[model samples]
Target chain A: MNPTACLLVIGNEILSGRTQDVNVQYIARRLSETGITLSEVRIIPDIRAVIVRTVTEARAAYDNVFTTGGIGPTHDDITSACVAESFGVPWVHHAETFRLLEAHFAPGEFNAARQRMATMPQGAVPIRNSVSVAPGFSMGNVHVMAGVPRIMRAMFEEVLPTLPHGTPVTSRAWHATGLYEGALAAPLEAIQNHYPTIDIGSYPYRLDETQRGVCLLCKGTDAQAVSAAATAVRDMIARLGFEPYEGEPAKS
Target chain B: MNPTACLLVIGNEILSGRTQDVNVQYIARRLSETGITLSEVRIIPDIRAVIVRTVTEARAAYDNVFTTGGIGPTHDDITSACVAESFGVPWVHHAETFRLLEAHFAPGEFNAARQRMATMPQGAVPIRNSVSVAPGFSMGNVHVMAGVPRIMRAMFEEVLPTLPHGTPVTSRAWHATGLYEGALAAPLEAIQNHYPTIDIGSYPYRLDETQRGVCLLCKGTDAQAVSAAATAVRDMIARLGFEPYEGEPAKS
Candidate 1:
């Protein structure tokens, strides 16, 4: 089995329904692209105890953990301190991160407000943030990043080149129009039974106001198994006198 | 402490980044509108064991537990059955629910695919779905609904009127346009100290592409206290000679 990861989305705004959690999807897709399955995602409020407990538990369980949000300059931005507390590490200044912060702001502008970005856990590696000076930090098995979508994506890009690569994640999907799930169940089950390594998923979607179709998605590392299962699905649809369109294959 | 709620978003598609978890934000905001505090949210894969474990734990802890997703006609739509099994109940069709479903779906349209939607655990009350025939079911401590945002929100509307009401959740927000967070830190802490019941939050937003400002938000059941805290924040901003534009007034 490859290394699995978990995401911890921390913010009161998320829980309060004021802000949408964009980081989860951003991280999940990026992790999947790297062949690291995002096993679980837990969203906790900005409470220090809860954040610490969640960080501790996630690090203990998952191969690697990523946390987003609560790293800003606001009073509620306690994720860095909380993560440091969880690891029992002292808050220290990262020389590189400090330089980045200084470069981001004018001489006098880099005051306490901007200095808050430099306070990282002891021995933590700074995750370079290209959009802003407030860099994310990584320690042990946890990689913490900004909550904003652009910043989070940038941080992930910066950190991706440094992490160990795993298996190549691949997927093939075929869409069978005008057919319901029941019509495809038996064939789908047979295909699933034959190719247990390839995960077969049937998503029923309503499109064009009146049309309905089931998009059979096959995902796994084994390309032969994925193609085989997808072929079986297309054959089943053809047998039913329906035109099965193999959707545009995802970018490699 | 008032009654609280938790949302369990069950879908592998969400975790895989194919589908974003919109139900959590909608449910949380809707619950807050009805005075129910949304304390926690968890997103797990469509696996039955994970769903059962998360559902069981959340139901035992929160006052009300609402789950979205996994109630469709596809093979992965196992949330309804798993939820029934978790509560030790047999999934049976209720006469009233069947009638409602029948009324929605014409004669032969309610086939096996649609029939799966009508099946519910024993002693479950049907949540009305204004948009579709696939009605959500509420059994014991858990409410299971569709993953689609529109259907979920409509089902929640029908379900909300039935749950017991709690404290009226209210909020006040004051925007400190383009002011640094450090400038308001001391006064913000004083405001928090003055109003223990109200939770205050500061959000930094980039302005005109350069300067940033912190929006101080005060949220609580007590309108007077929330307003007072907002006023205190506004006064402090004025004393600092920064033009603080009050955003939208307190809302429930």
Candidate 2:
């Protein structure tokens, strides 16, 4: 079984629709590549109680929990405090983080609010940020990072090497035009039952006025099983009196 | 106070980083415009127990709950069944839905799996889909819609008219260059305290190597208060020895 993970995106901007979150997808793809199964993703607001509760629950349920956003140098940024409260640990100002922030900013720029970014839960190790000076921290299994895409990506790169990896999932897709999902569902279910370990997904897409069809994808940890399922899916599509093309359907 | 809502995005493809969800943001923006506060968004896989648990919790916590995805004619499509189980109601084929699907498809095309799309929780009202014939449903406060962006949007537009709306949120943004968030944080906090009703957010952006600054936004139900807070934010930026722009800073 793959090591499971959950991503908690803490941002009011995301919930308010002021921002389209790129962090979740970026982290999800990276986690998939790293062989960690990203089982769940929650996009929550900057509420302290909610954040703490979610962090507590995710940490207990998943092998690793990643939280993005609410770690900025602003009044709305409350992720660090909430994380500390969740762990029942005292929030402390990390000496190395303080030094880094102090050096990154001008003398007058390093004010009290910016200093808040240096604060983390006790026993937490810092996740270095290449884009921004303020570092994200890892307390227990929960990894906290900035909400900004660039900073989040940088922090993820730094933190990924530290986490445990599982068997990477491999996927193959077959696209078929003039095929209805309802007509395909029964045979697809049979194929899925045949290969119990692999996950087969049938997604119908209407790219434009002219381009529209169903894309069948097979994914699993075992490369051979996944390939076999893909083959079966292709065969099923062919049997359904439609041509099956490798990869995703062309969108014009 | 605005009526609170939570969005449950149900799909494994989204969790796997295969699809960037447009539904949450579209729903969120619409909810904001309609005066409903979108409290949370959970992007979960097509798991029965998890969906049931999440739907149950969201229904209890929020005034309205919207779920998108898995309501299709495929093996992985189990949202309708799960939703029925969540409310402890029998999954039944709605006569109107079956008739609509029957008319939309060819005789042989309306198979058993395709018939699944017509199944919904007992007593649930169907939300008409303009893009596709397969109708989404509304049971209690939970509104279920299709995963496809076009279909989801159409369903939402149909269902939104039926739901109660509140006082819409108003917002104003002030952009400033060469101003640090740390320097702005203290004064922004003071402004937040001054107008407790208004929520002030400080967002820092690095447009390029040459352009970097913070954008301060004031949001609330009161338009006057939001405008007043925006003015104060502009004043704060000016006081910090920077020119405050009326809109977002130019990116080049």
Candidate 3:
């Protein structure tokens, strides 16, 4: 069985519809490459109780739990403290981080607000990133990172090397225009039954008024099985008299 | 208090990083317009126990639970059956949907695979949409929707009228290019504390190498309080050296 992971995107901005999140996709893609099955993702609020309860539960549930957002210097940035509460640890200032951040700012510029960024859960190992001087940290299996896509990616890159990996998932897709999902479903299910290890998916997409099609994808940890199932899908599409094209058809 | 909502995006495509979901933002925006508080969103895989457990929990925890994906004719489309299990209801054929879908298809085309789309949990009301002949359904407070954005939006529109609404949440923003979050945190926190009814948020962004800024926003269900807090934020921005600009600066 593959090692599983979960992502917690903690921010009100995402839930408010003010920000369209790109972090989930970025992390998902990276996790796929690293052979960690990202089984679940939750976009949650910054409420104290919610953060504490969610972090506690998720850390226990998945092999790895990643949290992004709510680690800034602002008042609403309570993730570090909340995570501490979640793990039943003291929220304390890391001496090295404190010294580094204090020096980064001018003598008077490093106020209580800025100091908040340096505080972390006890026993956390700092995740150094190229994007920011301030560090994200890992407490046990839970990795907490910044919300900004650049900083988050950098922190995640640091965390990626430390995670346990499974066999990388492989996929192959065959698409064609004018192929309807209803018409394609039966044959696709038969193919899926033949390869129990493979997951066969039928996705119908319409790019424009004239461009529309069904994309059949075969995905699994077994690379050869995925490729073979995809070949069967292509043959099925050909038998249906629609031209089967390899890979995703368009940007949809 | 506003009626809270939870969105579940159920599909392997999303988890696999193969699809970028647009349904959450659409549903969030629509829910906000209707005065429903969209508090959480979970992207979960199309596993039977996971779907059943998540749907059951979400329906109880929030006033409305909206689910997108897995309502297709394909083998991977297991959401309906899982949802039925979640509610402890018999997965029975919806007569109206069956009749409608059967009529939509040609002779011998409405096979078992296609028939899966017409079946639903007992007591489910069909949610009709203009985009597709196959109907999504609402069982209790859990609204099952299509994964495709167009179809999901259409189904959500139909579900909107049936939900209970609260006061619409309003927002206002003030931004400045040179203002830093650390320097502004104290004043922002004071402003936030002064207006307990409003939520004041400071978001930093970089349009390019040279054009970077912080956007301060005030949001609340109380329109007057939100406006008052926004004016205070605008003043605070102007009090600093940088010229305060109104509204979001760019597409970001």
Q: Which candidate is the best by DockQ?
A: 2
Candidate 2 lDDT over residue span B7-94, tens digit each: 9999989988888877888888889888999998999988889999999998999999999999999999988898899899999999
**TM-score of each model, in listed order:** 0.91, 0.98, 0.98
What candidate 2 gets wrong by more than 4 Å, as runs, is B250-252
**Each candidate: fraction of true contacts kept?**
0.59, 0.80, 0.65
Worst 10 residues of 2 chain B by lDDT: B243-252
TM-score of chain A of each: 0.92, 0.97, 0.98
**After superposition, candidate 3 runs with Cα above 4 Å error:** none
What are the per-residue Cα lDDT tens digits for candidate 1 across A1-252?
668888898988898888877788878888878888888998888888989998998999898888888887666789999889999999877788888778878767776756777888998998876686678988988999988777888988888767776876678888877887766775677788999888788877777667877788888878788898889988988998788888732221
lDDT of 3 by residue, A50-114 (tens): 99999998989999999999998887899999999999999999999999899999879998888
- Which pairs of residues have clashing backbones in candidate 3? none
Q: Candidate 1: misplaced stretches above 4 Å?
A: A92-114, A248-252, B93-114, B248-252
Q: RMSD in Å for candidate 2, one decimal?
A: 1.3
- In candidate 2 the C-alpha lDDT for residue B98 amounts to 91
Per-candidate RMSD, Å: 3.5, 1.3, 1.3
> How many backbone clashes does every candidate have?
0, 0, 0
DockQ values, each candidate = 0.54, 0.83, 0.77
